[model samples]
Target chain A: MMDLQVKLPGLNLKNPVMPASGCFGFGKEYSRFYDLSLLGAVMMKAATGTERLGNPTPRVAETSSGMLNAIGLQNPGVDKIIAEEVPFLAQYDTEIIANIAGSTIEEYKEVAKKFNDAPEVKAFELNISCPNVKEGGIQFGTDPDMAKEVTTIVKRASDKPVYVKLSPNVSNIVAMAKAVEEAGADGLTMINTLTGMQIHLPSRRPLIANKTGGLSGAAIKPIAIRMIYEVREQVNLPIIGMGGIETAEDVLEFLLAGANAVAVGTANFQNPLVMPEIINELPKTLEKYGFSSVHDAIGKAVFV
Target chain B: MRKVEMKLVYARQIAEDTIEMKLEDNYITQIAEPGQFIYIALPNFTLRRPISIADVDREQKQLTILFKIFGRGTASFAAYEPGMIVDCIGPNGNGFPFDTDKMEKVLLIGGGIGVPPLYYLGKKLKSKGIEVTSILGYQTAAQVFYEEEFNQLGETIVVTDDGSYGEKGYVTDIITDSFNFDLYYSCGPTGMLRALTSKLQDKKGYISLEERMGCGVGACAACVVSTKNEQGYLKICHDGPVFPAKEVIL
Candidate 1:
């Protein structure tokens, strides 16, 4: 039997495939199609201190081989998620990774600290890279100092391991990764969506209501591989790499580029069964490339 | 909510810029309801297009959809042939509320592309021995479609914006107090729905909505709309594409 298991900081993943944060709501919607336990871990949507209404309609627009979305982190504050969503996920065997985001450091720490008591939540994926919202998100993401500060505060407040999610919009990704690592982040989730926009030709205005949104899907895979390859050499932390992953081949590509595990984002919108389909195919895919196991392939393409 | 690769049984242009295609899928045809839509995955497009089920033939195991060439995604359907396959996830979102016993003289008001699902609902209601009247509005005579199909079911009215068809005005112009309906179902532009709901307040009605969607499964929260409910919001892709006209704020 092939070993598909992978171990990140606080997550002992049965397989390297899990849905990216925002794409899979709270696991309630998708539970109708398949079992939630089939996934290695469930990355809950970014939760803020207070309930967020998100942006207006037409928040999503299709691009070349990707899509742009400005969902603006529309989540029911941390209290509701912990009270309702976490307990529902606790029934499943999969690990739950809380993705915490906020407009202020106090809010971020508060959200993180609240989840520490929840036995279902195994770790925290610090969301400093969400590009859709007006404040906190993308602001801390683009700057090295802000990213480091948020990571430090959240890490200090939370009992579970904290992984800093990195944004691709930064000019110096290496600097950002190193800053978070120095701030005592346990792991990293790299290559958040690139900032992008689309225009409706007839209206002569932006298609997305936010005018700008985060671009994700198959089109952004190469950029993810390149970034993971760059960061794996310098940053001494496990990575939960994501961006445009569709097939099992994409999972193997992410692993070889130094990702300990992979999260699928926009591809879930394409095929709801995508994550499990990729999980079933991972063993054969890993063997086809002459890798014995998932761990055997991590960073195979990266040079020290 | 299952994924299947439906084989196109036939593809033909039913109207100017509008094409009608029939796909064969036993699973979908068996479960698909009147107002529910299928999210189709085209070859080159990143996002799936949510098209309503115009009609379903259970015995033949076929589903039909009538779509206009609105954009590049819809235009891709022009290349599909009878033997080709289309991958899609279906019978998604809440269909039109047909369980109510109050529906007697049912009125279906649809405009532009919104007329498709109403055709299915009209057929179902007619089979139940209920009186059905349809007012289908189009931009012009060239844009009109399914009038004959709807006419066979009951009294059908066709109106065009340019007076190039049956009547000169919108569907609302023909909706007078003389046409008494116990229950009504409407699918059209937001403006038409808002006007119709306000004009016929305190009456029981269901409205089908459209929005740019992702996931089409209520997970992405990309296609949510505000509601008067305590929750303050609902997802258009899952909670509805069909909703009680009164439950929605619009």
Candidate 2:
């Protein structure tokens, strides 16, 4: 068997597979299905300064090959996570990446400061791409200046590496990715859900209560692969590629697209054990392709 | 909590839009408590749909699920017949809490598809020698189901919203008029559950809430409910899909 480890700048993952933020929910529930420690890392749900009730009912809608969600970053606030969730997650062997989201830069600083004190959290994934919330969602990622400012502020507040998650809703994703990288971000998680909508025929109204939502799953993989390739060309920083990764083949595409690491998102909704399956399959895929390690596959297909 | 593979032994249509599926998965049957649900996946769908366990035969390692065909995914499920292979992840989420030794009399109330879970709970309570009274509500006589099965378990009452069945009006109205019990348990649409909670506010009971869930596990916070807890929110998929009435806001 071949080694499939990939080093992402300051971070070192056992394999390229990770559970995307919001989808994995901090890894506790998934532990029941399989040992979560087997995965490379677990991204906690996007946390804020206060508990959020999230959007109204019918927060999700089914799309053609994917689904749309407007969960509005419903979290147990930074205080509760530090006091409750972190301590429990500390027991797991996998890397714990605190995914932070906020309505303002100060709130982002406050969350980062709390994680600074907790030894359990290895890194922070700044969620500047949540499209559901009215404030600090896609607004921050769409503007290069706002993205840089927020990233710099969070970077200064935390001692841990900061990975800024970029939204695909913007016109120039490369510009936004470069902006965050210049602001001192350690890496980037590319292509959060794309903005989309669904309508109910009988009611003659939108299917989602929030009207518009972020689309994810298999439908967005092609776009995500293209974006990862684009970002990899412009930025020197490592990229966490994700969108509609459902199988090992999908993970390979992301690696070949220059993602130092890959996060499993909507696939977890289809199969909770998807991360493990991808992790176990990567080494086999690597050997068959005549690659010595997973890192060799990174950017392999980008030039082609 | 072992992750065991289950095979779909048979799937048969019980009504016009209702399908009853039986799986030969023992982990679910042995570990699943009444009122708990299973998340089933269709080969083509991107997400899994959760359906409550209607019946469980632990001795035979069989678990039955009753589902109504409401959309594309469910409609596809209806096409599945006996021996079709299907995947299921469960018995996830908490189930109804009942102490038969302590509570002598129990009331099981359900509305529409909500009636399915109560049937299982009533059966368990009956086995423990607890007096069980079941009230099942539907829209009309034609839509009413499982009245006979529930009757076999305990004293059963039927109510239809259009006055086309045993008792006219809502299930709560029937509960107010006919039966009295030490404890109550219910599952239904949010409106029905809220109405019952308000009518029986001073009383104590457990109510199961239905919400759009991302992960049927506790992690997503998608199935959160307002609670009296300091955190103010609780994961229905993990904490208690079955919550005490007082803790729930509505």
Candidate 3:
């Protein structure tokens, strides 16, 4: 038997395969496909200070191997998520990773503090890199000092382990990762969607409603692995790596590239059972490297 | 509810850039309703295209879909042949509710790609001995299809934006003061649906809608439409690809 357990700062995951925020809703929609507890965790949608309907029609555009989305973070707000979505998720024995997004620093602090007493909420994945939004998203993620400030504020308000989600849009990833770690982030999630756009041929207009969207799916896997490799070398915090991770082999590659865990993003839209399928197939994939435990794969691709 | 791989029995282009394909599947044939649609998973495409179920042959255990060449997804589907297996997850979405007794004198209206699902509804109503008046609209004579199939069910009227064939006008042009209908069911573009729902105000009916969908099971919230409530949004795929005209904002 292989040991698939992963220990983050305060949470112990049964496996490393959890759906990324936005792709997996409050777990109610996916609960129909399989047992919700089958996942190591469930990253809820990016909740805001208030309810938002997001951008208008045509929020999605299909790309080569992935898709682009400018959903603009449409959520029911932090209070509703805690009062309603949290109680429903309590039935499932899974880690509830609250992905909080805000337009201001005070909004971020308020959202983080709302989960300070909730039992269903186990951790916070600060989504500072959501490329689809207009404010307090990629803006906070692109700048190191701003990233540090938001991370410091959220970490101060919450009792749970706060994992700062990093964006791949910037030039210096190591500097950003280091700054977040210095700001007291318990861990890091590498490679949020890269900014991209598409145009309609005949009409010659932007395809998505927001004109630009976040790129995610199998097309961005290589970039995610490279960023995870770079950040693991500089920061000592636990990392949750993601981007275009579709199969079990991709998860192992990210694990060996130095991610303590991995999150399946756009793949879930294609197959809702992807997380369970990957979790079930992880052992068979790990045996190829003769590793009896999951810890053996962490940072194995990087030479000491 | 289950992901089934169905063998394509036949795929033929019935009209200009319009292809209708039939697949052998029992689960969908048994549970699929008039407005319910299926999500077809293409090999290279990341997202599945949601096509409405045109007709179902329960005895033969088959499902048919009529799709236009809107993008690369449908264009690829046009190239498919018999014996090829297609991954389909469906009999999905809340289809049109056909339980109302007020539908004795039913007016069925559809435009463009939206015309197919109404064929199934027309046949279902006819089976219950209900009188159905189907109004199908298209851009031109060459674009109109399923005329004879809809005609077989009841009194079918074909209209076009341009007078290439049949009546010359939009589907909404058919709704006049003297033409009293107890109920109506429509499917079309947002503009057409908006016109139909508004012009036929105070009349109880349902309208089938379309949106850019993500996870067709209501998870992604990508295909949400504005609802007349505090929640504000309802999923087009789950809450309904089919909704009552009075309930939806559009």
Candidate 4:
């Protein structure tokens, strides 16, 4: 049997299958379908210091192979998440990666510091690259200096590991990756949805409420894979790869492409049990690739 | 939620542009409730189309969904036959409250495609011996349907914008003091729900919402609505396609 265990900084995961933030809502919704303990880790929704109402109506729109969403980080504040969602997730035997987004650096630092006291929290997935919101999301990710600044404050605020999420909309992903790494990021999550939009031909209006939203799913998989390949080549930190991951084969491909683990984002909505399905299929999948363990497949594309 | 390969039992043009379909499946029907919806997987379409549950025959293990041929998905659905098989995932989201027994003089109001789920809600309420009064709205006389089925349950009132039907104006135009209703349930476009909430002051009500959804389940935060309280956005898919009329902002 091949070993499926992998580690990102100080956090250890039994398998490399976890749902991306926003796709999995604090594990409350999916728990009704299946036990969340079946997966390696749980990445909660993007939280901020204050409660956000998000965008207006028509937040999502479907595309050819994927969908676009402008949810605008509609979380119930960091305190409520800690007081409510965090304790609920502690029941499952999994690493809890708290994903936080902020309109300002102080907000990021406040969220990081607040989560620091929770022993159940395993890591901080710093979201400097969400395209749906107007402030403090993709603005921070595209710029090297801003990305470093956010990473620096977050890393300093928390004793836990900080994995910075990268935006695929940027011109140079490697530069962004190196910037965060240089700013003392423990790890990285590459390719957080490409910036995209669709228009309603009949009404002559934008499909989503935000007009332009972040696109994720089978449509963005190619871009995510390419970015992971490029960023993985330059950054020595462990990378969490995601985008359009719908099957076990997709997970193995990300693993081969140098991701320490892979996140199933848009696919989770289609099938609630996708994480368990991928985790169950990972062992035999690695065997087919002639690898004894998941660790053996990391950055294997370089040798190929 | 289980994905059932539902055999299309019947598909008929119920209106000028709408088609009511009955699918033979047991996966979601056992758990299906009023105001809950299903995600239909159409051939060649990557994303499943979310349609509300119009009615269900529990013993027959059959559930019905009504769709208007507005887009490619529904256009394809409109062309489906009686023998075609479709994949459906449901019964998704929290349905309307079947447990609340406080309201006696209940009124059900809906507009356009939103009128269907109210049919199920009306039926369920009537089964409990509660008096149900249904008010349905359409753009014109040709777009209206379910009048016969609704009449069998309780008082059925039809309103057409062009004044070709029972009432001359919108559904809310007739929902004044004349109805003397203590409870109200509604579903429709954002403008209608907002109007209903404002017009039906002092009356307790529930409104089912329709939003562009990612997952018909609560996993995707796309189908969220602002709540009246400080909670901000609440998911329409999970928290409700149906919510307390006073709780939701619109």
Candidate 5:
């Protein structure tokens, strides 16, 4: 049997595939389609200090091979998430990685601190790279200093491991990676959606309500692979790579590009069963490429 | 919702820019409610198009989706022929509530392509022996469909903007106090819904909304609508494609 298991910081994943944060809500929606335990971990939606209603309607626009979204981090507050969502997720055997976000550093720390009491949360994915929100999301992501500062604060407040998500919209991605690593981050999730927009020809205006949205789908895979390869070369931290993953072959590509585990984002919208289908196909894919296990494929394409 | 490779049994244009597609081996039809929708994944498109289920013949194991070509994704449906497999996922979102025990006289209002689901809804309500009065609005006579089918159920009135068919004005223009429908179910463009809600203030009714959607399963909050409650917002893809008129702000 091929060993699909992988370990990263506080997560001992049965497989390397998981639904990316924001794409997979709080796990209740997907649990109806398939078993949640089939996944390595469930990355819950980004939670803030207070409940946010998010942006207006017409938040999504379809492009060529991708779609743009400006959901603005609509979620129940961290307290409700801890009280309600966490317990529902606790019923499953999978590890829970809470994605914490806020508009201010204090809010970030406050959200992280609240999850400290919830034992179901195995790790925290510091969402400093969400492109949809106007405040606090990509602000800290693009700037090296703010990225490092927020990482330090969130890491200090949480007992569980913190994996800082990196934005692709930055000019110096290596600097951002190094900044978070220097701030004592446990790991990294590279390449959040690139800021983009679409125009309705008849209306003669931007299609999305926010005027801009994050671009995600098969279009962003090459960019994610490139970023993961670049960041893996500079930092010695485990990476959870994602951008536009949809297939098991895509999973193998990210694993070879230096991601310890991979997350499935926009693809879930296309096919709800995509994650498990990819998981089922992964062992054969790994075997077809002559890799004995998941860890064996990590960074194989990266030449020092 | 289970994903299945549904085989296209047939495809034909029901009206101008509108086509009716029938797919078989659809497990979704067995449990699909009238107002629920399905996501159809097309070639080269990043997102699936959420189409309302127009009707279902469970014994024959067939389901119908009637849509108008508004975008490239929907336009591609016309290219599909018999025996072709279409990837789909659904019976998604809540359908119009049809509790026959409480409802006696019901009004079904639909506009253009929005008129399809009401046919199935009308059939179900008619089966329960409830009186159904339908107000179907179309841009012109060329765009009208399912009028005869709705007529078989009960009284059905068709209205067009240009007076090309039936009555002369919008569906709201034909509505009067004489109908006295106990409840209403409507699916249409936003303007019609707004006008209907305003005309019938504090009346108990349900309206299905349309928006650009990501995941039809409610994971992605891409298709959210504002509400009058403290929860503030609800996802249109999951929480509803159908909602009680008074609960939503728009």
Candidate 6:
């Protein structure tokens, strides 16, 4: 049997498959379908200091091979998540990565501090690049200095490892990646949703209520893979690659592209049981490729 | 939560733009309630189209969904025929709240595609022996539906914007001319809802607000509705797609 036990700097995942934040919720609804512990980890939905109502509808608009969403970081403030969601997640035998977002640095620090106190939380996936909201959304990611500052503040506030998630809607992803690394982020989650838009022809208005939204799913896989490879070349830190990963084959592609772990996002909407299916198929795909362990495939295609 | 693939047993073009689909799924029919919706998957499209459960036939293990052809996904759904199997995620969102014993006379008002949920609600209310009065609104007479089906249960009033149907005005106008009801329920366009709220401000009622949803279970907060209550925003998917008419801001 191939050893699939690959460890990041501060996070030890059983395998390299995790359900992306926002897509998986708190994992309660999905548990009714299957055991959530079968996967590597569960990233909690993005949380902010104050509870946000999110954007107005229509929030989602379908595109070719993918969809656009403007969910706007709608979460039940940090306190409720820690009290309600975290305790519930603790019941499962899986790592919990608290995905957090904030409108300002103080908000980020406060949330990180809360997660630090909760022993059930394994890591903090700092979301500095959510593209749906108007304020503090993607602003921290587009600028290297702002990204570094948010990373530094979060790192200081939490004892747990911080995985800074990056935005694909930027001029230089490598610069942004290196900035977070220098600011003391333990790992990186490259390529958050890409900025996109859709129009309603009959009404002559944007299809989504927010006018613009973050595009995710099969169409974004290529762009995400390219960015992961680019960031891997610049930073030696472990990377969590995601965006449009639906099948086991897609997971392998991200693994080969240099992601220490992979996150399945929009695919959950298509099939709630997709994560388990991908996890079950991972071993067979590794064996077929003659890789003894999942680590053997990590970044294997980057040099080639 | 079990993902059961259901075969389409029948498909009919019910009105000018509405298409009604009946699928053979026991699980869906048994648990489905009024105001809850289903996510119909069209393999050709990436995202699933959400349609409200218009009616359910438990004995036949058939659940019906009424949809209007608004986009490519819905247009494709309207074209689906019998014997075709489609993936469905079900019974989602909070359904309409009605206390049959407490409510003696109930009034159900619907406009356009918003009329589907009221059909299911009327069926349930009728089963409890509660008197159901329905007012269905359409753009024109050719677009009207459920008048006959509703008549079998209780009294039904049909209305069209133009002078082409039963009442030559809005459904709310027809409602005003009718008897005072103990409880009122409505679903429709924002303007129609606004008119209903204004007309029934002093009355007890509930309105199901439609917003674009992501996960439909309140996780994404995509379908939040602004309320006048202490809680700034309520998740339409979880807290309610159904809310008290007075609490809703718009």
- TM-scores of the candidates, chain A only: 0.98, 0.97, 0.98, 0.98, 0.99, 0.98
Candidate achieving higher TM-score, 2 or 4: 2
DockQ for the candidate 6 complex?
Answer: 0.58
The list of candidate 5 runs beyond 4 A from truth reads: A302-304
Q: What does candidate 6's lDDT look like per residue over B30-135, in tens digits?
A: 8888988887677857776667888988899998878888877788788788999989887777788987879888889999999988888889998998898888
Q: Residue-wise lDDT of candidate 1 within B48-89, one digit each (tens)?
A: 999999999999999999988988889887779899999989
> Residue A76 in candidate 2 has what lDDT?
78
Q: Candidate 5, DockQ to 2 decimals? A: 0.88
Q: Write the per-residue lDDT of candidate 2 for residues A135-212, one digit (tens) a residue.
A: 886789899999999999998997899999999998899999999989999999988999999889989999888899
Put down candidate 5 lDDT per residue, B10-118, tens digits, no spaces.
8999899999999887488799999998888998898999999999999988999999988888878888999999998888899998789998999999998889888
Chain A TM-score, structure 1 = 0.98
Model 6 bad stretches (over 4 Å): A302-304
Mark the 10 consecutive residues where model 2 chain A has the least summed lDDT.
A1-10
lDDT of candidate 3 at residue B240, scale 0 to 100: 90
Model 1 local distance difference test score: 0.92
Retained true contacts (fraction), each candidate: 0.89, 0.58, 0.59, 0.65, 0.92, 0.62
Whole-model lDDT per candidate: 0.92, 0.85, 0.89, 0.87, 0.91, 0.86
Q: Evaluate model 6: give its lDDT.
A: 0.86
Going through the candidates in order, their DockQ values are 0.86, 0.58, 0.73, 0.63, 0.88, 0.58
DockQ of 4: 0.63
What would the TM-scores of all predictions be? 0.98, 0.95, 0.97, 0.94, 0.98, 0.96
Superior by lDDT: candidate 4 or candidate 6: 4
Error of 2 at A109 (Å): 1.6
Off by over 4 Å in 4: A302-304, B1-5, B43-46, B83-85, B98-104, B164-166
In angstroms, the error of model 2 at A132 is 1.2
Write down the DockQ of candidate 1: 0.86
Over A110-162, each residue of candidate 5 has an lDDT whose tens digit, in order, gives: 99999987888999999999888878889999999999999999888888999
**lDDT of model 2, residue B69:** 87
